[model samples]
Target: MLTVDFDRLGVKPGDRAIDIGAGAGRHSFELYRRGADVTAFDRSADDMKAVAEMFAAMELEGEVPADARACAEVGDALELPYADETFDVVLISEVLEHVPQDVRAIEELTRVLKPGGVAAITVPRWFPEKICWALSDAYHEVEGGHIRIYKADELAAKLTAAGLTIRGRDHAHALHAPYWWLKCAVGVDNDDNVLTKAYHKLLVWDLMHKPWLTRSLESVLDPVMGKSVVFYVEKPVVPVAAR
Candidate 1:
């Protein structure tokens, strides 16, 4: 279920981590479970409230470490509320395409990460996303839908320009791509279409069961048709002379 691989990102216990654009707090919950002091930041107040409640529920169920702290904050990505160099780790997953000024948002993410801190960013990969756009205007033309498609190189350049050094990269969720194509071909909003409904059921089963066959197939397909591309980056420590 995680697009950003935490092990590859080097997430550790006690790290101060922020999940920017943390819709539904999936990544935030994972961070908390890993014993991070986690913050789930988003623009939606109602979503933040739900996230906060979930964090509290996790605490009550002893799912999180006693010392692990987490909270939800409603905020703008272009203007993060935290001070510069505050967090040890940052996660911006499936979010950049929604921001018109994505570069500014990247700059803000970089500014808040402490020097040497790492971030994991994920986005919809170009070819699959392009296919979705071509199939359905409703997919991209919605009120808060994706605004742009990013070629891997273009995204890497933008992050480099913002002073983050790319450390690693990978593709994920190859099995889910065709399901989306089906949705777009039917109707993005049409949940009742037989093909779309069947595909959705299959995806749900794959998620819950994670059978070896589908997993193996997805691994084989990931490099070629993965729906999302992930980048791991680090903010370099400034030399004393520069300071």
Candidate 2:
């Protein structure tokens, strides 16, 4: 299931797109399928290796346009391995809350995006995540888990400070919020719990089939309790100072 909406992100054929902290290449694969020259960057070597293999598999399956290109690179989000103004689109989905220096990471993302380019950044919405934290210490206290919780305004302000203008914002994955609450209530690692297992099956079925009932329900619920909040922002064609 995708968090950031690519149509809203203004993806186009041949766009130079990068997915920063692309954990499982979900967005990167979508970008490639849409004919963008895609880069899937992450901090994990093993993840990147798997992503690269998937890219090749996709190519073999003719999943991407022949002209579209993709590669996976393992790197630090703090110091992106690209020159300034390099990518036409940038995505950092469900990643910022994990970073200790989120503002600095935002600066790095902003720096690499071409002027007038758009980006989609997402993070766990405050209340749902807060519930998870309250329910279980194991949820956010673990390594590589969330280091902080971002209030919507706080995150938007930081992006503005990095010279990005917020174009739009949205909330998504409303159904997943309750599932996480369930997990936190039981044990984050407890797949053995009957209720948790049942919920997982439901979620998996929803992902695979995407039947209309669940989709309609999610659409109605998304604005209320979406697990992730997405922000669409753009760099000004003329520098913000110039205007």
The clash count for each model shown is 0, 0
TM-score of each: 0.98, 0.98
What is the alpha-carbon lDDT of model 1 when measured against the actual structure? Answer: 0.96
- State residue 60's C-alpha deviation in candidate 1, in Å: 0.8
Task: Give a tens-digit lDDT track for model 1, residues 102-199.
Answer: 99999999999999999999999999999999999999998998999999999999999999999999999998899999999989999999988888
lDDT of 2: 0.96
Candidate 2 structure quality by residue, lDDT tens digits, 33-136: 99999999999999999999999999999999999999999999999989999999999999999999998999999999999899999999998999999999
Runs off by more than 4 Å, candidate 1:
none
Off by more than 4 A, model 2: 239-243
Tell me how far the alpha carbon of residue 69 in candidate 1 is from the true structure, in angstroms, after superposition.
0.3
